[model samples]
Target: MNKPEAASIGLVKRARALAPLLAEEADEIERTRRLTPKVVSALIKNGLYKSLLPKNIGGFESPPMVFMEMLEEIAKADASTAWCVGQCSVVGMTAAYLDADVAHQVFGKPDDIAAWGAIAHAVQAVPGGYTITARWDFASGMRQANWLGAHVQVLEADGTTRMRPNGTPEIRTILFPASSATTHDMWNVIGLCGTGTDSYSVENLFIPDSHAALRDDFSALREKGPLYGITTYSMFGLGFGAVSLGVARATLDAAIDLARKKHSVGIAAMKDNSAVQGLIGRTEAKLRAARAYHFSTAANAWQEILNTGKLSEQGRAAIRLSATYTIHQSAEVVETAYHMAGATAVFKSNPFERRFRDMHTIAQQIQARDNHFEDVGKMILTNSVIPRGPTM
Candidate 1:
């Protein structure tokens, strides 16, 4: 892959520098079920939120690998913050598909962040644009966002569901101010509590035509950059996969630290135990291998985009495979670390418990599901083209 620009390197450094603050605020973030204003302010101050925005529109449009590395670094400090950043960063990519004037109007501001979730209700396409009265769930990072988006199936004036050329229902993501929607406090969960992954409702909200964009549609893309060539969902897979790796890395490091200082009742110090040493060595190898697989896949796919100006079918499949595999592998490493930490892993005060919970939650997300392997396997078996879109 090509070298990342200076701005991209700066962003990664800023992410790393924010780690101590994120670690300090992790508990508060979880208690409040949202990022603190200070934390959000720091993120905005660092310009970390615009990691994937087009540079032409006062955005970074950072290299994909650089974006992944930044998220991984942040995830090491706080998975929820990293998760929220991942969600918002990818959501911001919608700017690439919107008209230049409209995109600038929506995302030109420094603090403009958007978050949306599972497509639920159909939106009526009006003469001017569309009117939506729908409720979406699992909108992460909405608590701190200035804008919210709804991915809905477009219904024509005749009350028919609009169809795309490929026979699927036409879906467009409509962006609107967060103030226009009623946010629900429904983010009760055991892990990644700081993400504030909650449900929200917008009633009879009128979205102008300029606010809607066909996400991940290459033909509809307005930006001309290799980064825009990749789909948003692919970026999510890469990012959240990195987040899982960060959680795994932190968990393992904690375990290693504990081993050196911790002692059992009847046995020697964990660090002195040959078995423990061997386990550490093996888990380290496992994590390194997973990280290698993940980054190498991303780098290869990025090189493809740089060379061909688009991500190929195989590139997408390989990314899905590597990302999903890395997430699962990372979870395994976290499990090993948590297990090695033994009873100490259960306490909230210690690092192992939250990371254990966060790792499992990451595995539960759509990007880490087992079915992704099946999808890629089918493609490999038939050598047939898979349907391309944000969801695929």
Candidate 2:
């Protein structure tokens, strides 16, 4: 393999090596409602923030598969850490669409930048830029992120919606210094709490035109690598799916360990029980099948992009389908393990308990929502293209 390929492989190993340390700090991370400074430092030291950034900007720009692999390994230790990493990595891809100098200035120091936010509301176009007045929620990694992005519908100076040729309101994601926005301490959640996915608000924040970029705008992209060819939303689906798979894997292993030692009043060890044995087998099969399907679909799309310099609509649809299916199946595997653990799974001290919560939370994310299935189905059945939105 070439140098880039070898470097990618090494990065995967590096991510795996961090798992033990992450697992050790999982409780602290959840309690703090954010990654500790030490954990954040570790991620920066390993260059994870630059995983998807262009190599020209001192980033790895690794293939999507490599990115997924690294996420899976990190998630195995703590889903929140993996989720934070996934969010930062995906946002880092925006650099490819930015002006060369601007991209360098904003993303040059990967260790100093971590961007996260939601797409909601609109920004009114002003003379030189836009005036932003919105509150974006679920801004994962916000606490540690030095930068934040807000996806907004562009409104004309007269407050009319700016329209594109496709009849959709033109939208752009505006980046700002994190200090410009006030964060609300509202990340209390049942799972993935360590992600620090709180609500943030900006009032009349003026961002220059150069600070915003049209998300997924192919024509505006400066880096023409195949990695940039994969739409941003599609990349999120893939990476989040990998995180679900990792969580399921870790939970299953915990169940197996419990079964080996725990004995009931009327039964021998749980491992010897035929029903428990069957549950484990079925869960393993489901997890493996889902993982295989997701990775295979991702690999095919990557290869197609490499060959054609772009991903076909069908390929994008397949990615949506596979990621949705993988996430749902992963939830099922986690549920099965949690159930089989019986009373043991209820205690917070047990690994199965937290993972169970994390799995369900993963299922609730936009990428894992069942609505994606319907979107993909409509595309396949009606021969329509996948609609460009969060569902993609």
Cα displacement (angstroms), candidate 1, residue 53, comes to 0.3
Clashes of 1: 0
Best by lDDT: 1
Query: Model 2 misses residue 12 by how many Å?
Result: 1.3
lDDT of each: 0.90, 0.88
Where does model 2 exceed 4 Å of error? 383-392
Give the alpha carbon lDDT tens digit for every residue of 58-135 in model 2: 888888889999999999999999999999889989999889898887889857565667789998899899898889
